[model samples]
Target chain A: MRSPHPLRARPIVIGVAEACLRCVVCCAVETHFCHVQFEEGFDERYTYVYHCLSAPDPASNPGIWLCTACHKCEEACPYETSPLRFIEAAKAEAYKRGLAPRLLTGIIAQITSTGYLFPITPSTMRRRAELGLKPLTTEAAEELRQIALKTGLAEPRGEP
Target chain B: MRRYAFFPGCFIRVRLPHLEALSRRILGELGVKLVDVENFTCCPEAVSLSVDKMSWRVMAARNLSLAEELGLDILTLCNGCLYTLRTVNQELKGDEELRGRVNDALSIIDREFRGLIEVRHFAEILIENLEKLKAHVERPLEGLRIACHTGCHILSPPEIMGFDDPYDPVILDELVEALGAEAVDYDLKTLCCGWTLSTYGSREASERLLASKLNSMRRGGATAIAVICPQCFHQFDVGQASAARRLGVEYRLPVFYYLELLALAMGFSLDEVGYRYHRVRNREVERALEVAG
Candidate 1:
């Protein structure tokens, strides 16, 4: 979403009020919320706890707090705002400064290196076929290279 | 003689062949030729948004590239595909700097994305060709009340979707009305069905969102709902059953992809529209057919 007025971009910061909202929505599970605890001292301190929602699991369990960027919270909010976007921006900043999880970083590397998320292993193909499904993609892997060329986003690795 | 590249997206061929077949039939009835761009990868909408921003743009651009090869605007039936392609097109169109950065990062694929082709939702096409749509209706869907669910992708993003009034869009509604059925106005018509989010998280949230949507439609006196997204169709139709079971409420609402309803009104059969694939049994549609007959 390009801002018509890019110069009008104010940094999306999490204020004390926003943090308070995040805290209210936070459950005892330490899922997705602001970790900054308001200390009794003059300075704010960061509290550390494993946000259990970030743990890896099979994709089926429904209760996990994997934020899917659907922007529903943004729409559903009584305040008409989103805490998740702010958190995402902060995470992006952290990653820019090299402070994100190794697993996440590794996954990014794999996707960037290979044109797939999980490897398109034979087992995965067989599993898909078992479901009476064919690959949904219209472009084959080789044709994908040609498409990449046309888009000018990338050239096939061997091509000049 | 006009042919636009058809992007069936994930839901059409794989999950809902009914919509694909119906769309093809309906479009053919309207004299619009749809050319399939086969072998297209998953839009990667679920994985890319959280994983890496560049791949999301690049992957969508790849699809757009295929469409551009045909030298026609990309006509998308799936709202997710529309949103995904529109997002990439918007990024490349509005921000040359971002386009260059994404293109450079995706250099391994031997591709560069140029925002050349027009990315249009099927709703948009109907809006553009409303006269043709109206003329194609052989059997008017009389007495049926259709509530249009445009979903989030085609609306929102004021910059990307500059064509429609995001908050109060009426293109789909107008198209629905053109088919000789009264397009019933309903509350929460623009609300997200929360399906994209459903792929990774709680089924509860998606159900809750569906309940909210159905509640709005029921309150508004809609007999049926018209959907453009397959995921939205799955959620509103299939998800409604589960939602009713979980929430302990009866939701008799029948959901149809616009193409299916349009094709039906154009004198096509329920089987032709792939009615058997739907989770929700549509007795009201049968009732409407009897009334029209």
Candidate 2:
């Protein structure tokens, strides 16, 4: 059975030992990487809380990764380590192994294809118009296209 | 005596009309006419690219194309919009195949992107027109403690934006000095407010970032923090309270777009330029009005 999380489709690897330690302690998400297996006082309820920096269980089905490059951990750590970086590295590994979320992948594909977050269409104009917006024209459009073509960005919508 | 096409970006017209008012007031005093190039749209925001780079660039390129039509260099006040315009301009200018592809995309919008116009942040214009700026300072912002917050999008990947010293920039400070305010020097001036990421998630992280900035400003003896980006202004002004709550400290640092402060020094009024839009309530602006008066 496939893992339910999109990150599960990818292979999450911990390449750097330093990164691994930071992730275990600082990340808000409990990646379950702790040696206190027999400890009875650990609060599982508060494990995911932003304030609690305790290490989590690393064996019980590994753990969930949730670091969003906020740099809070980096600022808090006495060692000046960046847990956010490790989380990103793990996410990249997961993505490489096809474990990354399909939704994120779709968004990335759309961005790479359209050079925009939203689909550009007349509907966009209609929505803006509804909002009482005037979608003004860009006079430099042709010149910018020439620059893009010369630079090898994606081809503008219409050109021989 | 030089003129360029002005793209005020969206925030200037709505959230921070002071930027529009101040820039025009000061620049007009300096004998520079900023032409609002007709038929221009949003420089679009960088957030769109984080969602989709292709459509962002294509649409952004469309805006830049408008500037090229009139054969004028682009002068922008909003840093986010400037970055968006310049990023697309750099991408298309540097890559031939990509330019062709984007141009092809532009054909659909009925625009032909030739990519000749040079995109510049307003700071660059100050750097280029330093002497002229000094000449127009009726009351240079002297004795005022002004800290600068240069947003991340303004300076990064150093090689591309050769406009100013990314690591140790003094253009804004110097401009502030020229306007009669003492540009309060401080550390962490180059740090990002994490405005882009913070608005989405990282609320705690974002607050922490702003807290750090406030601490720096306080340490630097800043009466107020001056910014070029509307987002930076929003983060530093509006986000300061939330950040203070997170850090468990009281931080009442005032933040203003550099233009607003410049307008104040240039003898504009609180009501004339709309000082009410600021997130943080301020008295330094009023003080400047008194000083100028």
Candidate 3:
């Protein structure tokens, strides 16, 4: 499943190829420390280089999986390569291929169905009423549903 | 007094209405009129964008269109919402092709994102009117010590966010001090809140990261943690106990949304601001109010 957007399907790769080859900030935990530690014996540095070289091919690259989108690499890059943006584009590609994490997919479904990341449950309405806040109007929900349908994102796979 | 449309994103509306209520009260008192922008959806958070960028962009564009229809700039309470709306606003404004695509989808609902308005975080607005904010302080929070957590969305990708120096954000600290409190400096002040990773199956790493930050705040003698984002508030407030349990340490740091602190300093009572609703007991905040009275 390729990206519906022409620009997204083939993002304009920014910066020189040699710049990424010379820069090692994207993989260095010391340069931009991630909260998620790598598993034992998994050489983060080697894995990072492997992924960085596989640019525009997220399926083959492991760096996209390692990046936390912390934007540290972008900040730390002396050559202004914006490595994080490349990683993000790769993630977008992965998402198009139905490779997004389950937790994220669940969130997308909820947003599509309810117009909120979290469900506006009965108790939520009760709390809002108690606090004198108005409920989410039906008109707004319909607008969101239309947006989702037009984007072909949250449609119930087979049912239109 | 500048009037702006208020976009209270999902978290504050659903999980923490008190933050919204107190923000309205505080902003009103400061002479900034907050008009409710009805029928607003999620800023369609970055996480959602990662899953489906086009859908996220269209949803965000729709929200921006609502603000443009009212001919008012959006004032957001959540950092994530500010990031999403502002980034999308810039993207749509700069890319004619992308804007055309998004507008085409929006046309189905009789809406078009003209890219006419700007999006701002509530803290940015407060900082802009610091003189007025300081003038309205009836009871300065003189001796209170607070650690300001600006969170990642409002500060990162500095070119897009354009809020403060991302590396050393003092905007939140300045706001805290305006209320007569000491903005305690701590290490990891600029680190991610780890909320995103926590949700994505890195629970241990998230807890460890949070515990480290809490430990730093404790070392700095901060009585409470001040946050501008509801998500960060949840991490420090609701997630603190679990983090402490995981790390085998005690972290009793009470989390206060920046507006709550401002509301209190500007003469609103504890009950008026809904401090009791906080998960971790804000004994220090309670004591500060009692002493001020």
Candidate 4:
């Protein structure tokens, strides 16, 4: 599916991760936009993530793949720091460190290979026709293929 | 009537074309003409951010440039597409350095990032023309209780999306009520659908997130779920079946693209709105249509 831009997208703003979202109550993790938080009981992981962020490379924290990029924590943060930017930067940094999960690299590979997230099968095209929609084609697909090659996507470090 | 360069994102155009068909019909009814732009690509997708930010902007600008060339703003159906395209458009329009770099990358393809056009999400457009939209409601949905999932990308990081209130949204609810259906209030009303994680992260987490949302909707007395984004629709529709099998709870909540609901209100039958394509069918929706229509 879709992946984030960068854990820290330097283009948008470098050092986004530097703005530590130290919620006075560590509520971002507790109020995380997922069921997994409640399922695993994350009141304590808030402390763990706080300590984890204090580490040398906070992006190396395992399970960056799980962030939905919802940015609700950023909305709810009392510290007024953008927690979404921190998570995004951490995710990108993980990729640069080559520790990106298979999914990130795999999706880029799919896009570079097919100019789409999923390879459009004949059946998919037939389905569009069945719905009386236009064929899903774009001339810029060659451009996407070229840009992926020229820019050199972040290489995967190892299994996610 | 206004016109926009239509950017039907890959997910709906390929996987769920019914939404596209219904959206185009409904948008036309609301007095907007969607001009098809052939060269537009993936909103390169928001997730592409994790892999490469530079490429994400370049590709997004490439898609925007095609619409800009035609002198029309871009209209998108999916919120992810709105996120990628609108953010890139807003970023490129204000920043000269980033635009320079992205233009350099685009030079290879003979495309330039002029950043002239605005990117629009359908909810805002439909909401803007609510009066016209109201006139088209041939069959008012009285019995249906819709739990509206506005989805994140359509309204978040408010400065960029610039649509509804990111934290507490009511446009979908207003639209639902405009159609005479009850928009039920739920606890997880504005939570992420967790489809992104389910795709490449943790299926268990995604399924759990979905179940909680479904359970919340059920408690709110929701008979069906309404979504504006294709990803949310898939999660609520197909994800219901997956969560049911694993969690062993039949959260039989049928999902509708908000536009599909609009189409139904415009007196299109369930078959005409493609309800059969929904993964989890609810008799309440069908019964509401039969008894009320």
Candidate 5:
């Protein structure tokens, strides 16, 4: 998330084959959380996404959706290439191809639809009243719609 | 008085208003004024990148510009918001081309990415005024040993976040100790709360991860778990109940969103901070409440 690293972080741009195989033995995300904690049949192995990226289709690894983008991989990478860059890149491609997890896609769609991840209903307002706070309102649609269009996440809604 | 555009990230703003309430009351009492800006959306959380990295950065820039327009530094209560806002602000400010591209997108909405202001996590601001905070402590949590979970976004890729030492963090612990509570050392302190996995990947896996974290805290003799992130708060508090229902196990460790703990120490009673809303309650804090009654 520091400057310059994100642009330079693309897996193919930085050469993932070079980053993942030899240098990234310390796949901290996997080593730290994934080994046995993952659900059944989910590959509990480390660098699962790296291996998936090396394979023909990059985003095939279920692990891609699993990364919180916490950047543990960025810290662990010996080359400082940020294995996270590759995961995110692959995730974008996966999303573009309609391969991202449904739950995650629903979440993104929720944002694109209302700008808020969760519904800002009367209940939320009632709860806020109890706290002596305000109702949160945003013109998120038009703004997010424009970005979604530019980023290829959605089509124009025929608005001016 | 320290002034900030309080960007109470969506999870807290929408679902957990009590956390918002406590944050506002505590910061206000401490002489920090929180300004709520208009038209601010969700911080867009972890999916910011994979959903479409460009839009992620663009959305984050839009939020930062809202604060920049006001010429105030943005303060975040949740790590997810901090991750998106702070990281994107720093990245765009430092990169000409990136800022230009984001600005190009902003042009669509009649805005610009000027990067005129800064972004920060609330804890950073609080930690800076340690002596003032120490003096405000009216109810010292003498025997309440706490396991501090800073959550992953506030740490990691030290160059990016730059808030605390990622590997050996002492800021949150120092915060706890300053409030007169023990910051208990436990295993897997730096591990992700698996909130991401629970939401986007595997519930069973996150539960297992939660089990291990709870086991570690119990072993470390913790009385409560203090989290600065809402996601981690939900996972530890709500996730504990869900995990118990599914796994036939109960680890009823109370979860406090650091600000609540701060309020308690600052002489605001538990009820004032909405302790009743916490899915899990601290028995020790409750016992003290009954004694006071």
Candidate 6:
């Protein structure tokens, strides 16, 4: 079942995939064996990542792979390529194929429900008052919800 | 004195309001005028990017557009927000194709990212006015030993971040020293605070990473850890107790937001910077102030 979400359906650019094939710094860092893996000739890691990226079945790919979104790989890449962009694209594709982490889906659900990642409980409101910050107005919250709905990132409240 | 639109990202505003309050008070004292930009949303954070890059870019662009409309550069207090907004600004400015797509999406909300504004981390603003900052220090933190945590986002992807050398960042250290404190050098100075990993279901690895970094700071003789990012500050301050429990060692390292340290050097009282709210006691900071006197 393909996701009906707009962002889920967005195409992964071919250029980004080609760049990842050329430089697999992101995959190396995610595995945390960059030093040893590179010393033994990174060709093996590169081929493995290429297959994961080009794989037809998301389930066939290694489930151990995870990008912490640290962007260290992008920083460390000698070629100045943004390996993170490619990693993001791959993750988005995986998400569409129902292979992304379940925790991520929970986060999205929270955002959709509250228009914020975390709930603004009474204690939160009291804390804001103590710090001299004005409360998040109802209108502002509505505007945020509108943006989320317009972007197809979230559906209207109380709708499936 | 340049004017800037202050972007106090969600975590700082919601979880660490004291940091936000101190930043405003200290920046005003340091001759930077902070204009509050309203109707701003999240930088959408990096997690969103991994799940949906286009949506993340659009939301970030919306925030950037708010600053542009105000005709002031943005001053971000959180490193995560700094990375998201700055990277979006760079991408939109450099890539006409992506910008068009993002702008089209933004049009629904009646916003357009013209790419006219610059996104700056608070550390960059301090470094830019280092001399003036030094001149305003009435109470020098002379004997204080600080471990500076630049956090990952402020200096990473050096090409796009352009704030400092990613491998060996010294801007935060320099700022710490200018206030008459010793910025202690330690291993793992550039590692992530493990906050992201902790949230993403790698709790054990994250706790271990924090334990190692805190142990290093303690061994390096740091009295307190100075951070510009709230997430890193949380790891050392509120997260320290749990970390100590997990590692079976005591870590009493007090964490201070850069603004709190500066507020002290500029002669603000402990209550003024909300030091009492910190999870770890501010005894070391109090002692440093007493010794400086």
DockQ of each: 0.11, 0.07, 0.41, 0.46, 0.48, 0.26
Q: What is the C-alpha local distance difference test score of candidate 2? A: 0.59
Per-model TM-score versus the true fold = 0.72, 0.67, 0.88, 0.90, 0.90, 0.84
Error of 2 at B125 (Å): 0.7
Question: Lowest-scoring 10 consecutive residues by lDDT in candidate 2 chain B?
Answer: B46-55
Docking tier of model 4: it is acceptable
lDDT of 1 by residue, B83-167 (tens): 7788788778889888887677556565567778888877777878887787778888888887888776666455666556655
> Poorest 10 consecutive residues of model 1 chain B by lDDT?
B44-53
lDDT of 5 by residue, A1-160 (tens): 4333432445364585455653434443433443223555534253444554465555555666767777665566666565667777777756755666676766777787777888788999999998888877756666887777876667322221
Residue runs of model 5 more than 4 Å from their true location after superposition: A1-14, A22-25, A28-37, A41-55, A156-160, B288-293
- Supply the global lDDT for candidate 5: 0.77
Off by over 4 Å in 1: A1-87, A90-160, B46-48
Question: Where does candidate 3 stray beyond 4 Å?
Answer: A1-33, A37-70, A155-160, B282-285
Q: Model 4 over residues A16-96: C-alpha lDDT tens digits? A: 335545552433343344333533435544542344345455566664455666666557656555545555677777777
How well is each residue in A1-160 modelled by candidate 2, as lDDT tens digits? 7445432332332222223343334323222212121122323333321212222321111122332232434444445554443444444434434444444454444434443333456765554454444453434344434434443433322211
Score each candidate by Cα lDDT.
Answer: 0.61, 0.59, 0.76, 0.76, 0.77, 0.72
Give the native contact fraction of candidate 4.
Answer: 0.53
Output the better candidate (2/4) by TM-score.
Answer: 4
Q: Arrange candidates by lDDT, highest first: which order?
A: 5, 4, 3, 6, 1, 2
Candidate 4's error at A78, in angstroms? Answer: 1.9
Classified by CAPRI criteria, candidate 5 counts as acceptable
Off by over 4 Å in 6: A1-66, A77-83, A109-115, A155-160
Candidates 1 and 5 compared by TM-score, better number: 5
